[model samples]
Target: MTGDQGTGALAVLELLAQEAPAARIEALLHEARRAGAADAELAELARAVELARTVQASAYRGRDREAALAALVDTAHDLTSPYDLDSLLRVIARRARRLLTFDMAYVSLRRTDGTSYVRTSEGDTTALNAGRELGEGPSLGSLAEERRAPVWSADYLDDDSVPHRPGIDAVVRAEGLRAIIAVPLRSGDTTLGALYGADRKVRHFTPDEIGVLLSLADLAALAIQQAALLERTREEVTELERFGSVTNTTLTRVRHLWDCHTRLARMVLDGARLSTLARAAADALDGVLQVRDPGGRPLTAADELPDLDEEAVTRAALQAHTGRSPVPLPGDVWVAPVTAGAEDLGVLVLRASAALTDEDVRLLELAAQSVAALLLIQRGTAAAEGPVRDELLQDLLDRPHHADLHVRERTRRLGIDLDVPHVVVVARPEGGELGKAVAWSSSYAYRCGGLKAVRRGCIVLLLPGSDASAVARKVSAELSPLLGHPVSTGAAGPARGAAGVAGVYEEAGRCLDALTALDGAGGTASLRELGFLGLLLSTDHDVDAFIASTIGPVLEYDETRMTDLTRTLDAYYESGGSPTHAAEALHVHPNTVSRRLERIAELLGEAWQKPAQALEIQMALRLRKARAALRAHRTP
Candidate 1:
């Protein structure tokens, strides 16, 4: 029995001796396959053993071959998709974390202004304040800026020179992080950004890993470039669409005006009622241009369009008559002389919401030129005959008579549509410099015919067929910015008969008075709807009392000291009571603004607390400034 046991033990020892070492597993498998193992069962056993040995060897090396293959497949899929730059970058961050077995991953972009920003992250972005300016930091951005290459640190805690927050370091330690790998995202010569990954355990990142990250970043750069190009293309297309819409709308209105002109002319020459022709013109131009008589009176009697300023239009008409170059209005107003031949009949004015493109201007000029020739023919016929002359005369007489009858007669004889409802806008240039104001107002008036000037101020006429209120509002809105200050506007109600237009003129004059009162008081006011007292205050106010009682202390404070009380008041008015915005405008701290405003409240007294009283005080201040500026200039 002992001998048999020893033989069995020897056989076991032989089997153990033939077993392959872990390192030589692949070689042992090759050898076994090459050798002639005749028994099928034995050969199968050998193959199984060799396969197990090979897998064991791979595991010992910590090589996750299947995981690596899956990661490669995911990367290939990401590269093929047509995602935008930001999305692709996010994918890259996520994939990198998985591939490197990292705790966190992120991407950052450099700006032209020498600032760097974190754009994407696999972890909580808010934790890192991603996309915010890296004001003072030694981060991946600084490394990328300096080397323009990949950087890695295995012992970040040892590097005291690196600027990283203690909280970040604590998180890194908690996660068992040992190293970081960063690769610059570049395309050709341009460096777009940086991609980084943090490993949870100590490990050396091979060159192959960096190469893979770089290849992905290159793909991201391509996506960014394409997205920018697409955005630019969309903007261009949108602009073209807007331009087309405006042109179509303007052309349609012009055609309607031409039809109205023909009907009105027939009614006047055939001894039809003047009111009928005037009403037709008023109806045609309603909500467009305020039409008025030569003296700047509204044409429609009862149903008034909103009041409009017509000073710019009148100036343009006079300029055209004087043989000057065509004047341009604020909203691309185009004025063409209305004449059959050498006998100047009148003027044709066309307006556009946008600055007229070259093509648009040419088309409008052509339409105006045609209207001008028609007016001349009509005027010649009217001058030869007594009453039934042309459509222009009948249209003119339809509205009220103007104070300047000679100008009105000339307008009628010339066959211009003067019977339209219109308003006059007077503009007195501010800032002690009249040249710029004169030039702006003059050019603005000449483009639209209802515009004119009396002395240094300009008067604009809203046309008969236009929306008087809308036009006035638009004019005021446009002119306010150009004047660097608020401008006053007067609006007239609609008038039908020749006599009724005078009442419209008087209303417009009242509007002007209101505007003047608001301006003199240095207050922000609108005349859309006003109470009786508000209207009265706007037109007739106790000037001495306003200066002495209302604005007395603030004016005295400004004269006596260098305190910013006056400046604060101006800023408050300018910013419309937004303390934050006022602070920004004054270039001081917000707390400083709060303090100054508190002081201003105390100085102005309780009466100034009310909005109405505040408005009155503001108006008074502005008027004083305007008067002072005027006086200063007069002294010279």
Candidate 2:
């Protein structure tokens, strides 16, 4: 072609790229003819236009194919959830109609006799459209099924090459469908059903459009198989339920077991405690409940179970770790192993008048499984966080002054506020059951929004509180039972911020030492609780502060009223707390000394003469005298 003709064709191609109107293209053709373009050049330009149109149509077809693939993928994802067959088939039919622009669409399932009946129909106006049955013959739906491929006809009524079945042909005539397609819904080599789409115009189905129809059929087959399995399962469950309700004895047993299962499942869902499960099992089995860890120590239970044969319980519980069911023990106790898959968590021990029946044992086992699931969840959560908590707590207690902003952020994520008042509690359980003590204390600390760590041989916790002694006693009381031995706790704090924890921990350690030295092991105490020993053993010896605190009121009363109450108090203590003897020591009348003692009681508390208070008072008096005598000896 000439350069001018090539240029004209190039202009037409550019217009096509811009998607110019038909009128604009026609005007351009007239100008080309008026410009004395040769008939051959014009014909070449026509061929270019036809080729451009074909390429443009092909691109549009490719875009449609991409959209169809995406839609089918999304539909497959949506089918991941459960669905009934009728609902799923309707969905498939509706999708087929929309994607292929079919005037009508329907799904048909093949019967055992090789006949197919419409299961679902969409966008159809006929009443017989859905229930329309296609007889067993070499027809549209069966042809696709036998060949395991898609079958289509441009005009079903006029297409003589395609063998048509009377029943299917009758429905097509009534629906006025001219073009129709069918694809087999296959599961492996077995065809379960067929999906059909039809239009009222004589139009040929494209290969890509046929593929889209096949995709919908695949989705329909998956839905059918899933729904079949679902229906079979429901039938089995219904049969069992029906059989159970037939007789009173069997019915009661089944109902009781089912109730137990439901309650336990609900407990796991709602995050109920192990103790709650123990109580539920005990009630269901009519036995006393005693839940024990693998090592034979008793855990918390809903009901207080009596002391049983500990050796038998431990032996049977351990045997249950590998056994399939609850292991029978002496003294009418059954131990059901609690496990998370292959990992043994613990055991549920039941004590009753006699060992439970097989069904009741199963009930107890169900409870054990529930307990296992809950423990596994707890263990998994702790496995991630417990180490971090322990490390942070150890660091905070050991090097509290070094806790910087990063440490603060870590603490914040853990829901711990470092700026608040906190205490350090130390516990040392007897029998060296460190593991049991640590476990119990860790749970206690978490609930209090505090941190726990094992330092030395003791379980230490940094807790939120001001009452150190109270915290100590609570820990000792609660942990002793879990450890199956006595636990002594010592605490010191109400310390604010990370910088104060170290000093408080040291003080708490000394308090523990003082308690043990006083033969108060297995008891709880704080520095102040130790009284004189606390004062002497204190790292920061505030003797003057102690003296002022102990006898400040009496000293102040003496200075303000110019009274000899101090000397009276001194003589009273020197005379063995006897006022008549103190009178002679003070060289005053007994009445006057008695009156001064009463005044002293008013300045101090009413419990001034009490043993604990009297000891503190006498200690302060002696310390004051020692300081004065030392000062006098140093004077020049």
Candidate 3:
């Protein structure tokens, strides 16, 4: 028995020297009991059991320390890894599971309203560990948040210290989670959320376990903050890029507008037309352009867009004319009014693919203003030239048939060809309408390339045409309405030169008088149309020619035969064709008058006694007696 005891003690010492673990120590102790050792052997077996427990405790502690260190190193590497927020959270949960040697682990972030939702999870098969909210009632995560410290619940479903929720209990039971430990994701005094480790089998949480999870929680908090800041920075960078784009666009448009303005201004200075102005505006704006006149006629080519709205353009133009800014139309069209002083010259319509900015509208307005200025200059020049043209016209038509070199030169300068067939129109307005007539005549004269003057209380125009009647009709029609009175016009034309023009004027004047006598007010006539009256009023009439056409034989017989037969014929007509009354006037005997009458009758033809022939004979004899009296008067 003593030897057996000694051997057992020795074997126990050998086992200790061999560094045998607890299992071998227990097996040897069981064998010693079976062999029924002495008290010393049994005592020695008991000592070995005590020593095995100590060695086992030490080895377990060493392993736990090593695992904790390895877990910390892995967590540090994970935190440094290039992972996004989600990936980082997953890594933290996974690392927490490894660190705590738990079955499951997860991360939860507290919402702004003090509720927590799971952020990431690992080793979870139920909603309990992933995607589940730590409900409003007490939970491991909430406990951690409220205390701003680490918390744990062994048999969480039955822990009285934790405020239990039925739903959370149900999920935990379904996920086979019997214990859970959580540490607040805290920085300083504020808790951001919670990090959790869970186990399927009931387990007690240690201070070291809580400390490891707390470190992970702190790292998670830092990662969450960094992610938030990075996200914000990205947003700021995007906003800056947008602002820079807008600024660049504005600057480019401004430069484009400057170039357009410079080119348009230069064009105006160079006397470009409205069409050119429209084209320049279109080119500058990258659009189609149309310029319209006051009459609504397009001064530029039409746009190719088939759906351009004419009515809308008109309305927009009207609005702009009232000093309102240009209005937008459908299809990205814009209309700006073109005005010169108070006059609305026209509108400018532009069509582009995109809506214009306020700067673009301003550019269009500038173009419109430039166009208005061009129109104003043109009108001013025309207004200034009006009087000058009127003066030149007056010189061309002035009368008295003066052969002055100045008149001829002026006529040439004025573009009047008196040598050509030209007509003169005399318009007489009744009822005190001379001013109106003059105004009308002035415009009419300018349009017709004619000259107007007030002569003999009538508007006289020297026009460049041969048809006097046509001119007279036109003057009467045009001036009558303006004067608000009846206008009578007499035109005489196809006149030879400036010198012969005076004679035509005289004829035209007599025609006027004849029209009035004949109650032909508002009548137009020429010399040929007036018949015998035209000859009487002619300035170029010859008295000798009148006598020859009437009684040429009687006058020739008196001169050739030295007879008084021509005298008898005149006296006979004065006596109503009776020779006896004519003889008494002549102080000659009736027989002598009768013989002369007989001779005169023989010289004159039978048809000369007719009423028409008699009238001609009477006029010729009267003209001859007037000539003889005029001669006697001149000789005295």
lDDT of 1 by residue, 502-602 (tens): 45445555666675665542222223333233335333344554565566776678679867777777787788878898899999998998887787778
**Model 3 residue 49 lDDT?**
78
Candidate 2 pairs with clashing backbones: none
lDDT string, candidate 3, 118-199, tens digits: 8788998865557777768777778778897778888888788877777777878788888988888875347788888889
lDDT (C-alpha) at residue 572 in model 3 = 85
Model 3 global lDDT (CA atoms, 0 to 1): 0.70
Off by over 4 Å in 1: 1-82, 159-178, 242-636
Candidate 2 Cα errors over 4 Å, as ranges: 1-380, 516-520, 542-571, 583-613, 621-636
In terms of lDDT, the best-performing candidate is: 2
Tell me the tens digit of each residue's lDDT in model 2 across 60-173: 754575577566655554554446778878878887888778999998898877778899999877787888777666888888899988998999989997888877778788
Model 3, residue 395: distance off in Å is 99
What local distance difference test score does each model get? 0.52, 0.76, 0.70
Query: Could you tell which candidate, 1 or 2, scores higher by lDDT?
Result: 2
Estimated TM-score per prediction?
A: 0.29, 0.42, 0.36
In lDDT terms, how accurate is model 2? 0.76
Query: Backbone clashes in each candidate structure, one number apiece?
Result: 76, 0, 0
